[model samples]
Target: MSRPPRILDGGTGTGLQEAGIAIAEPWLTSAALRDEAGVAALLGVHTGFLRSGSDVLTANTFRTNTRALARMGVAEADRPGYVRRAVDCAVAARAAAGTPHALVAASVAPVEDCYTPSLTPDDDALRREHRWMAGVLADSETDLVLVETQCTRREAVIAVEAAVERGLTAWVSFVVTGAAQLPDGDSLREAARACVEAGAAAVSANCFPHAAVPRALDQLGGLGAAVGVYPNLEDRAALDEWEHSAHSLPPALTPEAFAGLARRWSAEYELAFVGGCCGTGPAHIGALAGLPVGAAS
Candidate 1:
């Protein structure tokens, strides 16, 4: 039998939400570090994915940067501390799992609302903030830095540069709309080009409509760099009144369905990595890990 495909962890925020952990912020990444149960919940989620056979476990540093928490009234002086705490959570979780083969990846999310790329700051702020966060993660002992859910070409370029500057392997992932264009309506090819120009080790599609995966893979395939996908599962749990509504609801992509999709991508398009985004949990990742490797076509 061929070696098993490596799997990445599933969605953290949504997994926490589904587990009855709640924080009242629009961006709840680092806030969970403040709550003891939240930290434990995050650790549990990380350990869960590890036990489920994830090769790479992403740290929960998405909203830990100064610019993002500054919006939630977190002081600039205290922001980086939260990032350290987030890293500690991931490290602790990995150690608890005792999986030496699993590597910890620091998650670098967009500074602005992931749903709105237009809100991405100007070049100056983008460079300043992303560099700061990437530096923090590099110091956190993470194996790789994943700059995910990016939308704009400019930010993607800056983010990938920041990651590469820290001497860490990086993958810049874009979130696309149903039409397979980025949130700002730029072509995915342009975004991939920008990341590659910045020296990203890989380019990926993430946190978008599952139906958008194949189109994105088609666009990203044969781009001369490693390609990956970890698209969002539909049927997200209701976190709050504002986040839960008919408009936001989409069909649920269960773990089995997700595994099958990943298998297809791996077989046909030469996917370098496979995992989940929002609405997925360890169960989803377990299903992915359980896929049997087939003979090459």
Candidate 2:
């Protein structure tokens, strides 16, 4: 029998909470080692998921970027060490799971501010930060690097370039809303092309509200590159409120509901990889596992 296609797992930092670790102020806590117990607890959660059959594990470096570390008062010189530490945590957890075939992705996240593409650092600075982070991640045992939650095509370019420069396989994932538009109002298709032009191994949408995923995937067609999706589940009330307040959509669905949603993607994109994002945990993944290898839902 042919091997089943891969499904990428998402959101390990918050998933730590489910494993009995409180990842409060993830931005702040990720900088300092104050939450040592939390770190261990979080690592255990990742181990559980790996054992449960996740194809990919993202390192706990989402909020450990230099910009985020600087926000938490970490000295500039110490930021690289924090990133290294985060990568080590994921590596150790994956090793403990005894899943030799599991893939580890070094996660590079948005700078300090998110949801405001306008606040992104300028080209030179953005490139500098991305280069620094991607370079560090490349030196580790990580199998690949994921540039996630990017809201601007410009920022996406910097990340893709960094990945190519280091000769690491990279995936560029966007965070979008109902209309398949990035926070800066750039179309997802444009962003997808930008990543491809910059030499990304794949283009994906992540952390978007559930309702927007299908449309987002529809928009990804014919990009001549691999595409992926990992959406979160938000409650209806929470989704509506967040959309109105932040002008961003919410992803709200039960694990089964999300599985149905995820199942759709498998049939549509041949080069597709599907999984969970925010609000998705082991149950969501379990539901998806029941579907046929390429069945969407």
Candidate 3:
């Protein structure tokens, strides 16, 4: 019998924004590390997701890497402290929610923007920076490293390798432009295969539209390693708008509607896990947790 799908928590950055935290660059959600109020809001976000029945709570380390921090004018000496704080907040949130058994996955975003693969750094820089990020996560004792929203196959493979080299479990996820393609037009199959070979414990498609999950699964399903998806509940236009605006697009699907799509994906693909991305919240996750596993018609 197939195992039930594990529920990963919904969007962290968006959750922070909804909690009245301003989430703009060059710091993004990582700015939360700078103030007690922001940290408390982050803890509340994680605790809300856990209370909604998520099995994995991703730490808000998505922009705490040295390169990103440097752009934000954070001194190099203080960067690792930010990473540790991100991890500590997640661990503390898990404790606050009374769920010691739940796992904490550290966010490992691409060194550059997730949507612009052309901006990816050279191999040497990619390897060096990812190694530093993974080492810090390992040092902070994260349960796993989630190398997510990777747009280029090369960076994804290197990030996964760095995490695995540190003896940490790695799950690599891509930002796809089409059903079977990464943003740079590389085959999703090829990228997924490369990361898996590089020692990623799982592979996934993330930050795509909810309407695209069926086609995304067509590319991800049947890979020997565990496969999953966490799609945003917004269309292409709205996502693009949100990239330049302070406000996020309202979710196109209600909690029940979003859960319906997740139910189909889980039942049809036997996904290892299912969750939400942008434009999703604890209610969306709670709906996923309530789904019964079975084959979809």
Candidate 4:
């Protein structure tokens, strides 16, 4: 029988620090542009994951959009360079891995800050940011553009449109409510339908509780495209508080424990891809390697 689909690793920011980088504010991807050494440090973490047997390496451009940068005092003129640096960092990481092949993904975050769908920006703003990010990813050698943590239907569809316009394959992964539903409280069945209709090459639920993941997958069953999953292992209450406070310190999850959960879910769904979010790191992903992918006891 064929081997199971691989597990993708999670957030690179903290992993970069653990891999040894002096990051003052990890939230801004533009920090890489300001300090080449810092950028290199982050890229090194990507290499570490690749070396650790991860099949995918997501570029560290999550939250590098102009809107988020402006909040960090970055000027409009520097946005393009910021975006470019994000891609270059990933490229450098891939090269350092010495691997013959790996899927380098450009991570496109929610147009509006996640967990605050009411803050969803206007279409003009969303389109401009999405198009700019997608265009940059398109120009680079990225294998895929993964738009993640979408909190609303509108933002997810717009991201798909941006990717399609740029002739890139898009993956839309949403952040769902703790109740095992999409942010809008819609069923995943409905969410999957909408994502496929909007041109997503894959559909997933990311940055959610581990317990909720299998339910989310069940709700999304039967979408024609590949079904992926990357659940977070943090305490649900801690995540809610962090979202409310806009804090940067991520919660933690033991790799061994999360791996068991991932293995069980992966077996049941034969998931196309799986990984951790937020608190997940290399250890978590490493534990996922070689796990059975379909119909576990």
Candidate 5:
């Protein structure tokens, strides 16, 4: 029998912001590691997702890389500590939630803005930065490395290769401009294939509007690797929009509606996992967990 899909947790940075945490640019969710209250809030967010039956809890290391930290004015000496703290919060939250089997994935984002492919660093910078970030995740004992929201194929390949070189199980995810198209206008099929060839155990399309996921998944099929999606809570009308204005508009789907869509995606695509991106919360995950296992058919 086919295995049930794993439920990845919803948006970490957005969830933190919803929880009243001040996550500024250059630090993002990583800034939540600065104090006891922030740490407690982080743990609460993780435990909430765990209670909602998430199988994977991604650490808030999205902006802990050297390039991001340098922009935040953090000294080189204190950078690793920030990354470790992000991992530690996830580990501690897993322990607190009493779920020993849930995986803690380190978030390996692009060296620059995830949406602006033109701002991507040179090939050397990509390799060097991803190598350093992957080394830290391995050293921190992350359950896996999630190279997510990559706008370019080269960055995804380099990041996946770096994680695999450190003996980490890496899953790479991309952001798309449209169905089967990367934000940089590359074919998603080609990018997914490249990452798979570079040692990615899974390939996914993420952080795009919900309407685009099915077509993206269609292109992702037959890659010989597990496929998944975690789309942002944007409606079909926002398909061409990259920037999220979630605060100004109501959510595109209620928790129940989101769960219903996830069920359809799971059954139709045989998705290895289904989860949310921006604007999702524990309630959305809880709804997903309530769906019958092996619902895919």
Candidate 6:
């Protein structure tokens, strides 16, 4: 692990909200692609992360898939347009950042709410939905597809399979429960292995509570694959919804403090990736980059 870690960007939707985008649920990133101003905002966020030293810029397609946008009454035929727009925005951002090395990633979010395990659909449905999303993403210029905030092993496997089937590099990240296990109480180690077996190139976690990261690193380490993390900055009782409450949560972990935590994991796990999630902004990434380089200790 002599190489420096790849500094992935922080949260996109949460970052967008912090940037003053009036985002409504269901449609999510789709609503942001309807105009030039909105597209500029998306590009601005990506460039901000790049300026902060991010090596990868995840596209704002976290909620642009047919299954998610369907909840907002977006027609099936129009979903591809939204996905394309989201990817294009991130691509534009990388171009504008003038960092030829920055890579764009198409994000694949859970078909159901990430926190509610009971709401996870059947395997067939998960396969179909994930494949549909991955198909569109693979056709784009994105360098990879990240299935982030996954809660169940079934869904992780399904998502990974879809991305691999499309010949795209996949990363499957799980959202753990308070007990540091998958939402269904399954071992995170097992989940990571399952995803890897399904062709995921990386096993990681994102949108996890800040405190759960230690346990996540313990599990992600020794998995024989690239490990990474991008955790929320505060402790929340549930992940049912991503509440945009960073401004009010004063005295919470500052960017420097978050960077220290990332430094710890990067040292211990030799993390392949590190960044922020909910409540994390470019400042967090800047602080993280200031730390010493990572090693697979």
Alpha-carbon RMSD of each model: 4.5, 4.3, 3.7, 4.3, 3.5, 4.0
Winner on lDDT (2 vs 4):
4
lDDT at 278, model 4 = 66
Over 124-242, each residue of candidate 3 has an lDDT whose tens digit, in order, gives 99999999998888889699999999999999999999999999999989988645478888889889999999999899999876777788788876667899999877544634522
Q: Candidates' TM-scores?
A: 0.90, 0.87, 0.94, 0.88, 0.93, 0.91
The global C-alpha lDDT for each of the candidates, from Candidate 1 onward, is 0.79, 0.72, 0.85, 0.74, 0.86, 0.79
Model 4, which residues run further than 4 Å from truth? 1-3, 17-30, 235-253, 290-297
Question: Compared with the true structure, what per-residue lDDT tens digits does model 4 show for residues 3-118?
Answer: 67766877575575455544454454445557868776777677767766678788877877767777778788887677778778777877887865778788888855777778
Error of 4 at 290 (Å): 4.3
Q: How many collisions per candidate?
A: 0, 9, 0, 1, 0, 0
Residue-level lDDT of model 5, residues 82-192, one tens digit each, is 899999999998899888999999999999989999999999999999898987888895899999999999999999999999999999999986565987789999999
Per-residue error (Å), model 2, residue 220: 1.4
- Candidate 6 — which pairs collide? none
Q: Considering lDDT, which of the candidate structures 3 and 4 is the better prediction for this target?
A: 3
The list of candidate 3 runs beyond 4 A from truth reads: 235-242, 291-297
Give me the displacement of residue 2 in model 1, in angstroms: 8.6
The number of the candidate with the highest TM-score is 3
Give per-residue lDDT, candidate 2, residue 51.
58
Candidate 6 residue runs with Cα over 4 Å from true position: 235-251, 291-297
On a 0 to 100 scale, what is the lDDT of residue 70 in model 1?
A: 81
What is the per-residue lDDT of model 6 for residues 1-297, given as tens digits with 9 covering 90 to 100? Answer: 688788889767666676677666645555667778888777888888887778888988888767777887778898898889988888888888787888888888888778788899999898888888888887899999988988889888998999999899998888886567887888999999988888999989887677778888888877678999887765454424445442323224777788888888888889888887766677778778783333100
Ranking of all candidate structures by their TM-score, best first: 3, 5, 6, 1, 4, 2
Which of the predicted structures, 1 or 2, would earn the higher TM-score when compared with the native? 1
